[model samples]
Target chain A: MPKVEFNVDRCKGCELCAVFCPQKIIKLSEGINKLGYHPATVKEMEKCTGCAICARVCPDCVIKVYK
Target chain B: MKVVFERPRALSDVTTHYCPGCTHGIIHRLVAEVIDELGILERTIGVAPVGCAVLAYNYLECDWQQAAHGRAPAVATGIKRALPDRVVFTYQGDGDLASIGTAEIVHAANRGERITVIYVNNAIYGMTGGQMAPTTLEGQVTATSPRGRDIKQAGHPMRMAEMLATLPGVSYLARVAVNKPANIMKAKKAIKQAFMVQIDDLGFGMVEILSTCPTNWGLQPAKAMEWVDEKMIPYYPLGEFKVPGEVK
Candidate 1:
């Protein structure tokens, strides 16, 4: 099982993870959340290899994955 | 193969009170590592800021002083002026340095104070419920800037490293990010260089590290680093902004 989750309210919309990810699976949806920022979305769940590259690059420690 | 990543000898064994995934702990380790490598544990005195790292003295194994909000640089100035032989430094955050202590930093640099400043720029006020800090990017929304940071209303994000580099009294200034391994290595080198500047009895030196504040920025730790790399980097580019002996 692979789980991807974000504390939606905490997204700063920096979009670095999506840019740095080898798979490029992460994307920021135009949809606004409660925090009103364009939070990132895991658009391609199938492509996620759980390498945790996004986790390593994040300064806020907002992403978590379970494999 | 086993690698030990515990606290450095220059740092105490006490666990940091920083939130999980907070980069302050990593920064503390980096500074302590530099202190250990330079063998200035006994003679080093660190002045901590009143932000999230206010209790830094408890974690670092050396002489430490607690300064008021944004006053670490001023306190460090006094300490270094009195004890010219001791290596003195100040650990401050964006809110501390770019905001409240702006005048103190300017004067310190203008006077060519021989001290190192480890400036952590996380964009928002980390410990203070994610307020809009002086380094917060334009259009970036914070608790105080829910409608997004307007350039007209908020002025602009202050780039301390670039600003300080122009000061003639400043001998070294570098801006680095800690969002990944490569950048982290670069950041460590920059920090070491700042310390070495003081060790050589040079004038003011500072290493501004682009850090992340997940809790404040409302992003997962991973996304926060990404933001730092993408948005923050574009505004506050990384690399050595200033150094004495660099061939143009």
Candidate 2:
């Protein structure tokens, strides 16, 4: 299984990861981070393909993936 | 477990000040990744321009010098000439490079200044409230051009990559967009090649990246990227306009 980690504080909540995720497992959390934006989180880790598309699309470089 | 992706060591650890979904962060990461891969982090000197990426020095872990508005190429010239062994580059935006600092970039490229330039073109001036830029496409709506840019009055969109390719001094010139993962990968490769040209002492090199300004464009991050693909790519086709041996 692929593991995804997000540096919540670094996320600006642009949601590019969510938009680009091939698995569509990434989504914005209801709660805001220190910057007051709803940072992205993995909703269904089991479905994540670890393609790292989220990391590639994320402008903030806040996502990391391990396989 | 194998690491698929992580922050490059060439990037600083602090959070960036860019707006949410801003493509500047993506461009910054690509540059940092290239620096790390090339093993030139210690000797690389970046000249930050007077635009949204003015604080690029804060995000990039390398020696940096802040340049006057549109004068990054000039400052980079001086730095490269003085410290010939150092790898120098300039990070500039459309307003800074195409409008205010046009002469500086042209002269530097014409002189074969042996430096790399990362030009970010977002169509509008992001730092100055979305004013129409020289690279702004025809019929594009900006803060200053409420009714869209009029080609008769504003003239045509400036294609810097194609324009710069005409100069014999330039060794490499390419235009790439970060709208999608495949494009981002190609953009990174172009950036790396630009740096490599400078490293080999070929000549002036540049990679013009089509970026997005969602806040200024009044669109969501995803939509802004779509706009880039829909509107921008038609006018500015992405490809290597010039290469060392291919040109001339």
Worst 10 residues of 2 chain B by lDDT: B239-248
Summarize candidate 2's per-residue lDDT along B1-248 as a digit string, tens digits: 89989999998988888898999999999999999999999999999999999999999999999999999999999999999999999999999999999999999999999999999999999988999999998988998899999999999999999999999999999999999999999999999999999999999999999999999999999999999999999999999999888883
Cα RMSD of all models vs. native, in order, equals 7.8, 0.8
Candidate DockQ scores, in order: 0.07, 0.88
Candidate 2 docking class: high
User: Model 2: how large is the Cα RMSD against the reference?
Assistant: 0.8
Kindly report, for each predicted structure in the order presented, the TM-score of its chain A compared with the true chain A: 0.84, 0.95
Q: Which stretches of candidate 1 lie over 4 Å from their true place?
A: A1-67, B1-6, B246-248
- lDDT tens readout by residue for model 1, B135-212: 999999999999989989889999998888888888889999887768877888888999998989878889999988
Candidate number achieving the greatest TM-score relative to the actual structure:
2
True contacts kept of 1: 0.06
